[model samples]
Target: MQITKPTFYNEFSCIAGSCPDTCCAGWQIMIDQNSLKKYRHCKGAFRNRLLNDIDWKEHSFRQYQKRCAFLNEDNLCDIYSEAGKDMLCDTCRKYPRHIEEFEGLRELSLSLSCPEAARIFLSHKEKIIFRTVEKETPEETYDDFDYFLFTALMDTRDYLFSVIQDRSVPCALRRRKLLACGHDFQLCLDQNELFQWETIRTRHQNSAFGDSFQKKIFKWKDAEKSSDNLRKSIWKTIIPQMEILRSGWHDYLRDTLTPLYTSCDTEQQYQNVCLEFETFYPDWKIQEEQLLLYWIYTYFCGAIYDEQIFAKVKMAVVCTFMIHELAVGTWLLQQKQFSFPDLVSICYRFSRELEHSDQNLNKLEELLDWEEIFSLGNLLEI
Candidate 1:
């Protein structure tokens, strides 16, 4: 068996009580069977507290006013203090460290939903790198796994990462190229010409393709009115459909973003604010690129399971765009000032709302696919 993770994976440590936001709150903490049984047989003084805190029928910790029952006044876990780290359930033990299982491989990633993990990710100066290690274990197989498709997807993802990290290209152009790569790949897949991915990749690398892409981007910029309207319309329609994980998050979006969308009388004014926000934080582009790369690396390869290759990249693009929009709205709210810490807060908050919920993730993908808002041209326009 093999284990893979980002190079910065080991850098993450739970800040516990110091975390600006507690993971113990605003979400369900499911207790694994082994942990549940341990709780039932617990011989310690904390056993009664455990039995009272957990809802055995649901295999989850009961929340006290949207916080875990075990979460103490200091925002620390009482279970960890009383019973030790070994007592934590699978979810609690492995949080932020997400694992995706393949036939003989496990890919681990730190979920940005954790503020500390988000800090490690967004604050990194260098491009993200993935590392893999092999482990001795039992053999495993998936009856319906498509090894060939998976290989192609991995190769394409590597190519995309290289393109995205090629600092010479403007981040916007990198995004355009990434979307173009997805568009071409999807076309080939639809036509059952998956073998031509190499050709598509080769074409994208050519100087001519870059020139043409730049021209289209300029044209996209020229059609600001229509594009802005489309962008706003898409957000207005989709944001409402998302499964609201925390009512506060829904309110945050409504309170912060609603006015931004409505107040901008023209596309130019909106673009100006985005530009000004970027200028306010000189390294904003780098942060944005890092964010895009993180999402792509984390979720793109999962397309091998569902074969929704384009949708995966589309999700990354749309989510990154949304995060940027949130940042812009936040800047407006903070008297045209933005801080890295606040941006990190927004990123993790967005992740917590969307990434933590499988239902929301699936819904976003479904909405993107059904609406086709992330089509090649549309993505470029945005």
Candidate 2:
């Protein structure tokens, strides 16, 4: 078996009561079967409390206004304090520790969702690196999994990260190349020509198609107001999705953006907004690019097995793009000020809202399939 983690993966330590917001709030905490069983057989006073605290129909801890039942007044987990850390469920114990499992591989990453994890990630001066630990397992079982494709996927992920973290290339170009790679990779997979996949992968990895992609982007960059109508339409479509979040976000979006520029359609005005965004978070573009790369690379190759090519690309693009937009919008709303803590808070909240919710994910996947929306080139105005 092989296990891999990012270099900063081990730097996180949950703040418990000291956090500005607790993870125990703002989401349903689903109890595992084993934890449910353990809680059922308990023979102490706490057992009654546990039984009362859970909503048996949902098999989840009951919440007060979305806050976990186990959450104490001080924002600490009372269950952990009373029953010891060992008694916590798998979900509870493994939070912020995201796992991507494949045949004989378990890739672990510390989710940027945790404030501590975000701190460790953003505080680092160097690029993130993946470290691998490999040892033989006592028994090897067989399945229909493609180990060769998996190996290729891992290599492709590494190469994709290199492109993303390459500061020499502009973020716009990096994104263009990444999306093109996904589009081409899909073609190969669709034709059942797995052997020819390496050739296409190498072309992108070695900048073989990068020059043409760059030319297209440069051409589009000079065009004025060509993307205005597109941006407005997309903004209109996406704003509705934010209804799942706190109310007033729609007004917040318009108030912060519309007055500043009069319209999202104006090219120079949008450029100015981008400039303002850069000023507020100077390295936000690079950070956003890196994050997009991380997510795309991690999920892209595995998506081959499921053959959901466009959905994977859409997931990566939408996540990174929306995150950048929200961060920019939120900072502007706060009078053009933001800090690492605020950025981390936004990252966690966004991911928890989208990635951790099945209803949302399934909806997004369905939306990805619809031809009228979820266009990478259209969304980016490329």
* Model 1 steric clash pairs: none
Off by over 4 Å in 2: 135-143, 208-210, 216-226, 238-265, 380-382
Per-residue lDDT tens digits for candidate 2, residues 106-155, read 78877766777666776665677888899687555547777766666666
Among these predictions, the greatest TM-score belongs to: 1
Error of 2 at 164 (Å): 0.7
Tens-place lDDT digits, model 1, residues 1-382: 9898989899988888788988888778888999999999999779899888899999999997878999989989888998999999999999989988888889898998999999998998888888888999999989889888888888899898888788886787788777778877878888999889888777777743366768866665434337677777667767788777676777898777865777677778888878888888877788888888888988888887777777888887888888988888888888888898988999999999888778888888888777755556677777
lDDT for each of the candidates? Answer: 0.83, 0.70
Question: What residue runs in model 1 are displaced by over 4 Å at the alpha carbon?
Answer: 207-209, 215-225
